[model samples]
Target: MKTIGQPPFYSSFFLATVIIALFLGISSFVTYQQTPWKAPASADAKKNPLASDAATIAAGKEVYVKECQSCHGKKGKGDGPSAATLDIPAGNFSTAATQGQSDGALFWKIEEGRKPMPSFKKKLTENQAWQTVVFIRTLK
Candidate 1:
């Protein structure tokens, strides 16, 4: 049934739903385009002072479990319990995109985090940060 001057209620609802879906799709694409989590050239040039020895990896594992596991997952897969709520996704250490990054770049990202990730510069020491990087390398 249709009124002369009014569109059907379902048509209006459908149109609104379509608009919302389009808006959300566009916004997600825009966000992805803007979030280029790349470390600077200088950061890439920096080095990891700690070796990936057993002791260092052990220490890194401890820190990661305490600080990063909530968002990065126990296995560094970026599918932690809280990952679903984030505006930007966490880095998945198992991926080649992550494994290919230099140690310094990973260190920089951990030290100076992006919007959803907090900076660890003050929370963790340089040694600990490097140790975490070592642990990350083992994720692959």
Candidate 2:
């Protein structure tokens, strides 16, 4: 039994836990927001060799449906069933945040994913990845 003015022993522990949780949450949000997912300058320079013709777009759409629709949504709006489960928001392909990126940057990102987005480098060939970029362009 402590004095009325003083908090109990467990109170200190509870306060510490709350403070740590808040710190971690804030840090995580700030970290995710602060960093831009831009690829290397060299990657930006790389060009998409495949034409954006109907056949290429069609192939890309097929791949997107099979691979990305689970997380990126059927319309590429980042509202897929799995999107809710991720700590980070699945990219909305229609948004400028994604559409503004060059084809090469997008392709590199697909090749080298961040914490939540898995790298398709092993799963998809270079051509497929490039085609994915092309398909993403038509997302709007």
Candidate 3:
């Protein structure tokens, strides 16, 4: 039996409630993903100690393959094997949004990662992380 005052299956009020809930859910997801990934101003000022030469980039590539390729993709398009499973999509190095950030900012981010992306400080030496930045440049 139906309730005396409950919403019917297709009532406008019921539909509106469902739509609002859906919109809120989608908005929250977007907000979580679009949250800024910024480093401190001090980090932004820091320069890359390593050169952008072949050897530097090559060394970076090796590390990236082991540590990052699963998420950042083979060419740094953020389309790697595990990307689909992540709540936060991997960053694409080819885009201007990534390239626009300073090298120091990149290093800082690698050193102190936000949720989803792990902080490489413990896993990689400072030089290694810097080299990874150099390699990332080539992806653009």
Cα lDDT tens digits, model 3, 1-140, are 76988677679887899999999999998877677787888998898999999899899999999999999999999899999988887878999999998999999999998778899999999999999999999998
Question: Over 4 Å off in model 1, which ranges?
Answer: 1-29
Q: On residues 1-140, what C-alpha lDDT tens digit does candidate 2 reach at each position? A: 45888888899999999999999999988977757677998988899999999999999999999998989998899898889998778878999898888888999999999878899999999999988889999988
10 residues in a row with least lDDT, candidate 1: 31-40
Worst 10 residues of 2 by lDDT: 29-38
Query: How many clashes does each candidate structure show, in the order listed?
Result: 0, 0, 0
Error of 1 at 134 (Å): 0.5
Q: Arrange candidates by TM-score, highest first: which order?
A: 2, 3, 1
Look at candidate 1 and tell me the lDDT of residue 11. 94
Colliding pairs, model 2: none
User: Per-candidate TM vs. native?
Assistant: 0.77, 0.80, 0.78
The local lDDT score (0 to 100) that residue 26 gets in candidate 3 is 99
Comparing candidate 1 with candidate 3, which one achieves the higher TM-score?
3
**Model 3 clash pairs?**
none
Alpha carbon lDDT at 118, candidate 1:
94
Query: Which candidate should be chosen as best, given lDDT against the real structure?
Result: 3
The CA-based lDDT of model 1 is what? 0.91
lDDT of 2: 0.89
